[model samples]
Target: MSAKFEVYLDHSGQHRFRLKAANGEIIAVGEGYTTKSACLQGIESVKANAAGASVVETDD
Candidate 1:
């Protein structure tokens, strides 16, 4: 059970996406996009950048 991205339509007819963990948890939620292509691109961008993505520590 590997992590996967899921694209779907929301209540407002906008396209959205989410990354689900192997355990079926919603690890990340994407912003709404006007087109499915953009939604897919968003997923692709995540795939491309997530490998070396960095975290910026901030004061809480």
Candidate 2:
């Protein structure tokens, strides 16, 4: 088993996605999108941009 992305509708009927680990724990979530296609695009953008993403610490 490996990590995977799942797309589903929210309580407000908006399209959203979540990335789940093999253990079935959600590691990440995407914001709601008006259309399913846009939600999927958001996933692709994460795939394309996150591989080399930097980690930064910020103070709030």
lDDT of each: 0.97, 0.98
Give per-residue CA lDDT, model 2, range 1-60, as digits (tens). 999999999999999999999999999999999999999999999999999999999997
**Native-to-model Cα distance after best TM-score fit, residue 22 in candidate 2, in Å:** 1.2
Assess every candidate by TM-score.
0.92, 0.97
> Cα deviation in Å at residue 7, candidate 1?
0.5
Off by over 4 Å in 1: none
Ten contiguous residues minimizing lDDT sum, candidate 2: 51-60
Model 1, total clashes: 0
- What TM-score would you give candidate 1 relative to the actual structure? 0.92
How close is each model in CA RMSD to the real structure?
A: 1.0, 0.5
Expressed as tens digits, the lDDT of each residue in 1-60 for candidate 1 is 999999999999899999999999999999999999999999999999999999999999
